[model samples]
Target: MKKLILTVLLSLSGVVAATAQPMCCYNPVLNCIATRTSVRQYAPTAIPDSVTTTLLQAAMCAPSAVNKQPWEFITVTNPEVRNAIKQAIPNSHAAKAPLCIVVCGDMNQALEGQARDFWVQDCSAATQNILLAAHSMGLGGVWCGVYPNTDRCEALCKVLKIPANVIPLNVVCLGYPDPNAPAPTPKDKFKPAKIHVNAW
Candidate 1:
């Protein structure tokens, strides 16, 4: 009877130990953020429509300036359109991605007066959200700049037939990462010198 009681106590102790383990020991958000690296190379697999919708939902959830959400998204999956975009920006490797999302800002939707200038910032936030969401979903993505460059912007606008009021900010190239490709090393970017106590 004592041996059986000892076995029961041991089992209870094991259960207690297991239950004592912290649930937050593995933080998915932090893991996702840390593991997120710009992926220029991708596999040939296609992204599903459900995943695309989730990514767009994540992008749209970003905060805007003065509640003026002026961002728009255009998903380009067609080979012809992707080729044209590639031709427009010869330096960008995003054309090779399985899916490309064009993030845009609408001038008409911007707040009036000086606040209108904040549309770029709002759109940029949305773009970042999309990239983070893609990474969290185990997909890879890279942000290819477009808005500031007049030539590149004009070329994309012409190719995509974008409207006058809407400005393409950037293109997010997304896909499953190529397994053969080398993973980028995560760097320690924290700098104590960059921090200021009160004023510089």
Candidate 2:
């Protein structure tokens, strides 16, 4: 009877320990999600290659329509090239960040109308992944839109020499934070009438 009681207590303690440790550091993930903000200012310090690769890996993990994975990333670390990109993008503060990742969607793999206009959705998901991963890594980043604007797209196309079918979706700037940014408070974006109980 004593041996069985001890075994039961040890098993219970093991279960408790497993649950207490959390599946994957939820607090840090929550901290990343809660404290993440669009960091416009960045320190000139360079980020190590390992960190950059980790962030890209996280971005690539984002889901895509039909598993088409119609996404491409162009990382620009050269100051001269980054400066040129900044000039091409009017009012884009991406140059401040030490690194910039250009997110694009492959038109050839798009389902209909480039995934029936679903390319943006897929690209946006990737961008969000970049942002979240940057935050989680204790780095700051921001997503700056570029594709929809013809002038901006044309300028980038001329500079990068990208093919016509590849669409530039956004430019993600990443670096060590230079400011104490605030998190966005959740707003009531949905109205009560918009809610449907069981039927529309």
* C-alpha lDDT values of all predictions: 0.88, 0.82
RMSD of each: 7.9, 7.9
Badly placed stretches (over 4 Å) of model 2 are: 1-27, 179-200
lDDT of 1 by residue, 1-200 (tens): 99999999999999999886443346877666666788999998999999999999999999999888999999988877898888987766666788999999999999888788799999999988898999988899999999889999999999889999999999899999999999876555557799999898
Enumerate residue pairs that collide in model 2.
111-115, 112-115, 112-116
Best by lDDT: 1
Q: 21-103 in candidate 2: lDDT tens per residue?
A: 53235677765665667787787889999998988898889888988888988988898888889999966676788999999
lDDT of 2 at 122: 84
